[model samples]
Target: MMITMMKSYRGKLHLPMLAGVVCALAFLVLLYNERISFLSSTSFMRFNTCAARRAARDATDGGRAKIDDMEEEDKLEYDADICDITEGRWVYNRSIKPLYSDRSCPYLDRQVSCVKNGRPDSDYRYWQWQPDECSLPRFDPNRALRKLKGKRMLFVGDSLQRGQWQSFVCLVESIIPKDQKSMKRGRVHSVFRAKEYNATIEFYWAPFLVESNSDIRIVGDPRKRILKVDSIAKHAKNWLGVDFLLFNTYVWWMSGLKINSLWGSFANGEEGYEELDAPVAYRLGLKTWANWVDSTIDPNKTRVFFTTMSPTHMRPVEWNNKDGIKCSNETRPVKKRGHWGSGSDKRIMKVVGEVIGKMKVPITLLNVTQLSEYRVDAHTKVYTETGGKLLTDEQKADPLHHADCIHWCLPGVPDTWNQIFLAHL
Candidate 1:
């Protein structure tokens, strides 16, 4: 199973591989040049306890209990295929330092460079996700580069996806010789190149997955979002012929109770718009994306993966820290297993599962939500930037209003996400 992408590289569609090394990560890289496309959830506890719950509920009925016992028994069985990687806890391991420091990765975005942003503690980098049933392979850049040889891997959707994209780049970029590597930034798309392998790691910014007004990397009013829930071709055209596509979108859709959705083109001056409940709009948007996958992709040639919604830590009250201001000053992970925060919505996750379940294409879901929920301390908090600018000392001083609880600190949680991502490959 695999989950990710390369977008156009602006070369010809279906361009055969340039015939060298593979280095793409996340969404649409075209195979005509070998495009990689990156393409998620539940209370995990609710599923984990299914067998036990069945045993209890069926105890009174001997006939029903017998059948349920056999069926539910299958749920507890563990194989490499059935390993519940999401049902894990964060272990504080001081021995395991990050593969790349914020300083080492020149491409590290200011939004998640906590250490460079005057963060005093490095404890957050020490915790590793330990699966109760099996061990995760430690991240190896050389091996990962080999996995990506002659491939274009694409990471698509929102800034969190960008964080995961950045994590993958930082993990693999350090080893390539200076002359062999290059990074290019664009308004809607970006590519990190490794000439030695003829590989490209790329990212495309499509915040809502489907077309949206907030598709740009930076927006004037971030909260005033609008979606073209019925369309995707505007973005999906670049994803064509990608070998691996990794994708995600959720936080941006939850900005308010109602989301403004457009029916026509963004060129039509925002006409044919209507206000619908966020969930209704979300379902339509996902359906549009699903229609593209079912109609366009050939699963045998292109592996598609959708990362589950990344969790947030904005409300300290959700974790029982009544006095804490969001994730501010927090330096330790939440120890509770199956800890579901308010930041992660079960309803949205349900939509993801339902839509993916209905798709004819085989899309591997990188379920990182449950594991990340424990990393309450991993957010950039007040140390990160806003609107692409570093926060001032005065703004950082105000943790309550200024703390960024949505994005994870690099070399912190996103590295773990990439680890889970690598496991599938």
Candidate 2:
């Protein structure tokens, strides 16, 4: 059976390879200069272009080029480049990391474009994606979302949770027949309804998915009391009977201070959270979240997904770039480094995996962290403005510290995130 399956797969590869070869030949003809040359100088441009398209396809399909065919050093070099963060390696699979490329996404066609100079730093703008315009082969969002209609999809976490929610929304909304779509915002939940699919996508902001001091209760004197973790049940109970529950909570816990007065404890006095360490706090929080999941969320009725931490590009030295410089103006999709593991902080990953390990429910993990760790350039601060009209000039200037270059550009990275979501769903 394995032999037969392998042959069947090999047979499948034949067509794409032949098609790629034909496309490569046509480009060679176009670059003939004066005439088609069989024995003349080489056309490096055509050669590289064909290689790029093929390489992108291979990587996107999760096929690392065969190493046995090349010399040891060359094989190693290719492996390194294909996974390079600076190269924006995720472009091969842009559905998960939308800002991986400045060029329009092949899946969505020209609907996604770079706003500022198509560099890495320019990665943070909206993609203007159109479902109808997308040319890439993909599982239909209408079909996937159809399964979720009338079902509540909740994103629970901190500000970064908003990023994934926005991404998931834009992706689903694009597929929804526009005439049938509607959105309604409430104090705790923001719902997007697609009449055509009968689906209601909602976002409920719970920085901590569990009940923590941050969500409820006041500490210190009333005059000086700062708002912190209050009540998780106030929000968590409302998300019951949900069809999809996407959870995230890292950046906010690490935010150290209040992210915004609205999402945090500003009024509560400075009896700050004693759980200062991110890992310990995360473990405890997940314990609470797990207790809730096991107690309330029914696995048969709801699909639960936990988004791994979204890495920030604030550190340039990690990517071999100079200090004070952010991920901006990077056109080429190649990383200077080879390994994704080298760039990420593994301690966090271990804690996350450990928490999930204890869960009785199967949690789908959107593990874009290591791969995203390298994409320090794909942020939107000081670039475009649509969703975030309230932030000031100063906020945009200090994106590394202020404006959220940490999140993701809507319609770009999030679209891919939705794609992954659909695949799992």
Candidate 3:
């Protein structure tokens, strides 16, 4: 059609007609290109805007997730502050593994290392402390070391406190290199130092928490445990400037129904001694210790904690086991809540409360007594020593008179005490 039109117009082709045809085609082509360029620019702007918005939204969501995690941790810490952790029950969870084994910790005393001494069963190590309202965080050894950096945590009391010290050392030292740690097992003031942290976890042998005849690291006579109910100068000198002081004096104070109390020097040949009822002597002794704490301890420098009386499972009949003797052959915890055995004196704990209650400086009490009463299975139970020596074959055969039910096994109840302790810190 264009060829026929062009042939008819070829002879009559005029300059104005040719110019008008060319101009019309040029106008149409320019308009089409301009429309395509406008659509392309619009599409690019829309894509760029959506992509930038999506990236910003993703960043905001990530930040919110991180903030939520931090808030949860803060909530846990708050709950721990409000709840009574001492009111917990012992949950026998089989999945529980000890923080450190007796074999792994060379710092363990021969007495409390029941696993290494052939206790035969490991069921006692399985009981976990579950609080009624809040759960304790799993203990972190590295964090404990950081918390105790450049500090001295001194455990002052009898052998039971010594056991707790041992458990704490094992917990933190498991992560420490051998070259960075040292143990000084002195007769009176034993020390375990982590050189990297410049921190020491020590035990000062103050059985009565005052001057006592049994303060002799190894006593010649076990029957003559006497307390000079008004003396603290000698022991308090060692306790000065300690950062964390954990004081306990229950089992050692329980010698008999009556204890010998003295008013003068032990060098005076027993001339100033009088027999007082055990509770009376205990109260007098604590008064002396509390006076020392009130006067000598600068609360700004030292944090004081008193562990409640750790119970003893001597007679199984109290737990309704007529066939058993001492804590021997026990493989499980006491099922009853608030179970108090015949061995643990509630009167002694009352004295502790009254003394600490009247103190001038603040002293937090780690009330692990009731929870510990449920753990009859955790005692050394004849796998321990009587006088710093492992029990003989003859002593092992007689579980009634030889089993050391007073001290709990390592990686056992004392670990839980340390757990509650870390929660406070």
Best by TM-score: 1
Question: Which lDDT tens digits does candidate 2 get at residues 1-425?
Answer: 00000112543564434545555565545546322211111111113333444454456447875322222222111111111112223333333343333333222212123353222443333322111101222436566676776677788766566666655555556555558787776555677777866677777777666544444332223233222333355667887878888888776555542221223443455444443355555566567677778778888888788877776665455555565455543322224434443324456668777667667776766665644555444555445443434345665565454433565544455554555456446
Give Cα-based local distance difference scores for all models.
0.76, 0.50, 0.75
Model 3 over residues 261-294: C-alpha lDDT tens digits? 8887886676668888888888999999999999
Q: Residues 354-377, candidate 1: write the lDDT tens digits.
A: 787778887778888888888888
Which ranges of candidate 2 are over 4 A from the true structure? 1-88, 92-139, 175-179, 212-231, 257-275, 328-344, 384-403
The lDDT-based order of candidates, best leading, equals: 1, 3, 2
Model 3 spans with C-alpha error above 4 angstroms: 1-81, 220-223
All-Cα superposition RMSD per candidate: 13.0, 14.2, 25.7
Worst 10-residue lDDT window for candidate 1 reads 19-28
Which scores greater on TM-score, model 1 or model 2?
1
